[model samples]
Target: MPRFPEVAESSVGLSDAVFSRLVARARERGGKVYPLHVGDTYLDPYEGARAEAIRSVDHQRLHNYSPVQGEPALLDAILAHVDRRSGAALDRELVQVVSGATAGIAVVVDSLLSPGDELLLLSPFWPLVRGTTQRRGARAIEVPFWDRLESMGDAAAVEAYLESFVTPRTSAIYVNTPHNPTGHILAARHLDAIASVAERHGLWVISDEVYEELWFDEEPASAWMHPRLRSRSVVVHSVSKAYGLAGARVGFVHGPATAMQAIRGVQTFVTYCAPRPFQLAAAKVLTEGRGWIASTRAHYRELAHRAADALDVPRPPGGTFLFVDTRGRRRDGESAFAFLERCVDRGVLLTPGTASGKDFEDWVRLCFTTLPPDDLHEALARLRQVLDDR
Candidate 1:
């Protein structure tokens, strides 16, 4: 028998401990399971999404492969939304849709990096960022966020890292604002500093702004608006979080015209195009569903606050997760995985920190976005009991 080499070894190794275990245990536990491990919104989908899907199927355009870059209507909608949000005159030529942000990231990595090139990564990251880049034979040189921040901000460390690590072999730097796993919104000064580093080093910035809409207080600053960084950056965003459309698998990559063209080239060999029906649905949400989007954001904000209050854990600035210090909460100094197992026994499934990176071994992420208010409250109660008892 012949064995084929794996195309995504690094990516496949970084298991999503919380999600996989929860699925198995939920099946075993049956009705007693209270799933708080997953980050999906328990909220209903936007009404416009449903109506638009019906309209799209009726129009027959949804049956065809969308324009190679994206369906024209969807591109226009993305451009209009960006213009309204950033006051920047974004052209439709700069937008390319993908299956989701993950696909967009893949295309960017493949288009930019050669094997053995180094990609500067900001950690603790989405894990897949490092995994995917590494799978392409690139090294992920990480600069830790909080440690670098000290009291200043992560931008300073970013600047320092670029100066020290960047070389001709360095191809790109990944930045995630309103970051996952840890919700650190990039500061304006940090972004400015990062832009200077990118300009000096001629490094590409792959900014994942998937959680840009989930801010609690202030609106997030767009790294795309930075003059020095605009032309060198690829901004990847998803409608999954904002529109409750994760299953739809819709996202877009907007950047300099040259890289946008390159992303299209990469997508041609990949998924080819975003699903036509989902793009049509996303277009409607971007154009005509501001009120519904606002309502959803407000609901998420309330849920974050409520869950934080119940857990008595300070909430991060923004994003769907509540990262908790689970250390010293279990007997015999149990590992995060063990603590997770105990919680599962009590019917609350949570994401263990080890999945994010090795540095977060004692931490665990509580997904507050899904589960109703009362259900979340009960889960928190059960979690507290499990922790206290242990």
Candidate 2:
């Protein structure tokens, strides 16, 4: 039989098996489901995105092929925004724009590691991080964090916990603050500990800050703002969550000039460049839309609280989702899939926590910003009813 190789087929990322089934069944049932599973926003693109998209329609350069690193205007605008926010003046030459955060992640993994090199990861992570590493023939050494992080208040203790998992083959560490699926933002001391460990080991740090602008209770923190880690970090940021521009598919990664050169080179074939019109639209948001960004963040913050209250979950300090702990709440012999199936039967769709990692097998994720206030309330009522009946 003609078949795929082991490396190509070994990981199918079936973590989403429950989600896929729910989606398929929802379509087959031929009616609407109250969706809290995805991170999509109920809002439109930012104030100026559509205007820029329209303006770029007649520009020939925006229509034709451009440098793989991205359009100059877009790159400068991004760096300017970064400098204003992080107080780190970066050289424009060190930045590379790509199709989206997903593409940016793939580019970094492929560019930074050789086959068999180990990439240290934090869990529960965005599944894409693990999938990309494995596909690049790299090993992922996971340090389970989310479960114990909130309880481990000491920064040095958190650093020590991460250090125990490191080995000689480890080449890089990935940090996702305002983390996906859980929406837990790492504290400043936690960021410092990770930075200290990375600096001491001479390991690369891939900082994913796509949710940088969505902090609700307090200001967000980043390793990019740390002086010691700046020389060896790849800071990946995006407009998808912040500006409601996910469909535009624009994101970028920047770091030390030397490493970015390699990352930029890898982009010559992979993605090549972000779509120009979208880049122009994103550039508008990056350079001149802080007020709009602040308002959007405020809106999501309000929704976050409402969702947390409805789900009976602790409100995350930041980000747009609430993580509902269903550990002892599940029926005997019921798997995460069965719990989610009941939510579906009750007409609300949620992302089973197992999809992100097994560490979260007893939880589920629900996004607050994805539905209107009343719809969100109704959706949670359905979810709550299912759990109550269980």
Candidate 3:
């Protein structure tokens, strides 16, 4: 039905450049624009885990392809890391390394979803996931849940709310915590609710644990560790957010052996293998980066408080961002894009809330960890002015 040059219908209208215009406008303003729109940290990774520390002299054939499952050392490190955290040992056959969580999630969706299948996304989610499902010709059903957690009543209410979105086409539910946009960690009751729904409907659970090491208070339990969800869940982990090694692009996935077999088969054609040298570096980081994580967590926690104070929002308990409701701050007749432009005029850029979910058009996501303390303070000051209509 399509012409030669036409792209697939599923790929059309996908978010390719949601922030390009704002970025270009920020550049035109030409004065110390702080990019708080990105989900990253200003800190460098641990010394032993840096790419420069992994040398060809130390690692034979460092540039060559790693085994699709992962480098043996990295695999062992991941297994040990899981054991230490979850108190359960993972069989090596259950793990497969991929380019990053982004690619890793894509591979899982590709393996689990068929055309027209539905994946329930907890709303105000990481922005790219909707597009990830769309590219697979699957529907991403956004349930407005995260931002409303405090007012959503009990765990029974949460379960009912999520269940309302499930249909015969529903095949999976993707859960992330210390969640993106909002920093809410799902509590035990919340996890129980999710597991109950998955069990009732026979849905696969996709646990996103990229921020597993970035919580502010006590570490939240991994969602995949729920006994009922364990068999059907595939958990994805990354050193990118935890170790400030986003450029390294290394992450791993593990689940039950049966699900892993499908994931491993799909991974072979997706990325073949993660970058070999970085896999070695990631292994070192996983095995030895606890102190680094502790310090960075303290640093980010401080920044979260500072940013929240400046913006007059509650401090995020975990993760790097604050999802702010800008409805009350916007001028009469002003659009969300116009509100963002005012911030850009002040030489600060934040992500539009619409990027996270369709229901969040008047909200915005600000990443407190993207800039160093001084720059972030300055950016928050400028952003505060816009929010205050100064």
Candidate 4:
């Protein structure tokens, strides 16, 4: 065994920064690299929100650490937003603020999942979810859904998966709506189907709704809002994508008052509390930044549509990305890494599907946010050339 307590084998490994290392090496050689890989917006912080942050930093109270749960003002604002949107009529005590959605998920996994417990992951998932669950020594079992979006769109398929796959050892079910790689938003029927599964199995539903506000055709149904599902579900949301405050790193989780208390206990040990000034900025954006999310969504939606038109693959239903499939030229399987490499040879960069799971080998997740019309067009054009060329 290796040193350091035998380092319990876990799945989480290597940050997406691995791509940056590759891109950096290419740059050093004067190779062109267009970075479409990460979901992060190249867009600068929302101007108004940034100004508020700078101003808040000047406030004497911000220099100190926040309360272990969160600052009262920020916490209350989050609760009000949740009550309004989730339509769950939750009290302030049910919410705990954290550094980001990722941190909130960590608290949930640490509190609820145990070693050997089967954790249900809905693939293609965001990479961090897989990393966090496995790091806890819990087995991550993926229930492939979106790849069969056509079939999964029929609620019966999702219902069957839930009915057949969940076992007594299943501790949690993770839902990523406005899903990461495929960009499929979970509809009310889908939520109803999942809620039924959770209700029957007595499982915890950990819903990551960081992109809830970015839904394309309709509003997303909150799992916590389902009457039968409310008691067993915890909802996580962030100011990053919607408010263009990714750097602020402020998010909240709300659910059962009992579970909220447990999350607070976990939060105390990890981050203590989110940064005071960042919380202050997020609070303002949530309560007063309506125009910001709308403008950003419209801008991103236009770009996403353009990407779909440009790429050879079908478009994702709704989200900030277009997951492109490029498998025509390869004899072995065409992986996201291989596709990304091809794009990099040109002047474009995109994330490989392998980061999510081996299942996404043919899928390339390309972020369409922040790039101006001309730049997005150019990037897509370059991507086409890379795939079409040798």
Candidate 5:
């Protein structure tokens, strides 16, 4: 049943507009629509790291294409930042700067996975990773995680549960923490379980550390820092989440030298290079934004607790979101989408939980950092009314 000039099968059912309908509804209603759906900060980035700070007068070829790998300055900064955070002495050749973590992961998928290969995607994950796998003609095997960590009991049990989902076709495991949606940071024991499973299967570990700098309590150890996972892991990082420079589109990926060779090759065919000016900006942030990160972390922690208290959910350990199960609060015969519509009617927008995982259809994800304190408080107040009315 082939038609002329048909699109690829992989593109089917993939959506880049998960929030379009809700956003349209919000637009129609007018007034202030608190955008709690997207994961972004209301605060501006550090002054020196901002795009406006980069000037043609200061740097040569400020708008030109950077080298395929990346600008040397940004790469050096990433190496130093990684060393400080994880204490790993990475070779300079092992790093590849890309447009962002999304594209970085895509390049990884292209390099490592063949069609029909499986990626062990821990859920509820960052929404885009699922589509990233699908676009590669690979399947994302969702193991209900993060939200189920406490109920899953010990690390051994977690390992057993994850391993049970693996099959001969599974080629890699994607790990993110402090996780999106739920915001639970994986402890060492959990990483041990993941490493054990990946090592036994000889599968690659794709460590997503974009939220690495956003932890609330103690600093979390990187997955690549684990002895067993070290050689097999390829870690991805972004300045977007921590520095509030999402529009800059700068992220870096590093791994074993051999694996990085293929990733860099794929990067050439993808975006070629991240924007040169933003690379300079990202370097500035990596080197000079620690104090900014500390103050922002404290601010985010307070906001996280406040939002959690308002929603009556457990406070997130890190990351920007609170994944709430709205099932209990739903009216009889009302669907998950209906509950979301009720919230939007009150001028508050939330991401449907089904965006994160197939098993999370009855849940909703809220970003406390998306709005400033006064606006966020008002949004929560409107949301509370909807919850109470049920």
Candidate 6:
């Protein structure tokens, strides 16, 4: 077997360890697996968007490589979409399309973080955030955003608490609004406070806004758009969730020209450009489909409430996933791993909290968007049975 580096060997494994066992059991029983453990939508792409991709492929757009920055039409459409949706004035020079938000984030971390540097990450993060930082020979120092949200309720207090976590080696701050796992959407005012702290500390900010369009009751905001933070911030966005186009692998990052210039070279070495037709298709979705996204937001909001009420947990503020405490499900002398094993045995699959963060070992994250109402409700009901038995 081939060996790996010390860092690679030491890094946490992100596999849904329990889900694999669940898949095995499903095969053994020849029954449908209740899939509530993924962040993808089961819905089809909008007709207009699908047709655009087909049209491009039919005409052979996929055969050509795109500009290193982005397809011009796609970049223009992104600028317009961001301007209309977020009210941010951005110049064309500041934007560059990469693969997906995941790759865009990797590009940002690779560009900004250096060896022996530290990145301050809001904790219980997307988990891959750690790999992105560590792979660059940098460090991701996770600060618990939810713990701070609870202990320091005020925006100013939360900002100060975040500052306390910083060290001299810190190079940047990575934050996600409508955060994955917790679904905690940072308020505009809270984001402003974070921006202020970043400005004062002379920190670059990488804002993950992939879930920006999924907010339930609140208007979404990003740290990159704040007047104080704009010059030092990069925002990563994608069409995966809002437009049901994860397969397209189209995402972009926008920042001041100074940072974009640096990131462009790195992106060239890494992903070069997103698939040409995917970029054009995403542009079509952005330019042609706003009603679809608005309705999706409404549907997820209602479903979030339904799931939360059924699980007896608080409603997720945004995003398609929900992190629920499964501590109560443990039986005598059983660990959370054991609880999760039992859940799989009962035919319901969840991402065990171990994969996300050590601090969340007693929790499980559910993705409610992939299943229809009936399936989701059935899955949750099965989860309740597993939790209640013994």
Q: Which candidate tops lDDT?
A: 5
TM-score of 3: 0.98
Query: What's the true lDDT of residue 167 in model 3?
Result: 100
Model 4: residues >4 Å from true position, as ranges? Answer: 1-8, 11-25, 28-31, 51-53, 56-58, 329-336
Task: Pick the winner on lDDT between candidates 4 and 5.
Answer: 5
C-alpha lDDT of residue 181 in model 1: 74
TM-score of each: 0.90, 0.93, 0.98, 0.91, 0.98, 0.91
lDDT of 2 by residue, 286-310 (tens): 9878888889888888888877777
lDDT of 3 by residue, 1-390 (tens): 558899898888986698999999998889788999989988889999997899999988999999999999999999999998887789889999989999999999998999899999999899999999999999999999898888887779888988999999999999998899898899887888899899999999999999888888887778788888888899999989979999999999998787799999999998899999999999999899889888988988899999999989988889889999988688888999999999999999999999999999999999998898999999988887887783
Query: Over the stretch 180-279, how does candidate 4's per-residue lDDT look in tens digits?
Result: 8778876667778888888778888998888877866556666556677777888889988877777788998888877788899989999898878888
Clashing residue pairs, backbone N/CA/C < 3 A, model 6:
none
lDDT of 6 by residue, 31-77 (tens): 66787877888787777777444564365556589999998989889
Candidate 3 stretches greater than 4 Å from native:
none
> Which pairs of residues clash in candidate 1, taking residues 3 or more apart in a chain or in different chains?
none
Query: What ordering of candidates by lDDT runs from best to worst?
Result: 5, 3, 2, 6, 1, 4
TM-score of 4: 0.91
Give all candidates' CA lDDT scores.
Answer: 0.78, 0.81, 0.91, 0.76, 0.92, 0.81
Candidate 4, pairs of clashing residues: 34-349, 36-349, 37-351
The residue ranges of model 2 lying beyond 4 angstroms of the native Cα positions read: 1-18, 56-58
Question: Candidate 4, which ten residues in sequence have the lowest lDDT sum?
Answer: 7-16
TM-score, candidate 1, is 0.90
Whole-model alpha-carbon lDDT for candidate 6: 0.81
**Each candidate structure's count of clashing pairs:** 0, 0, 0, 3, 0, 0
Candidate 3 local distance difference test against the native:
0.91
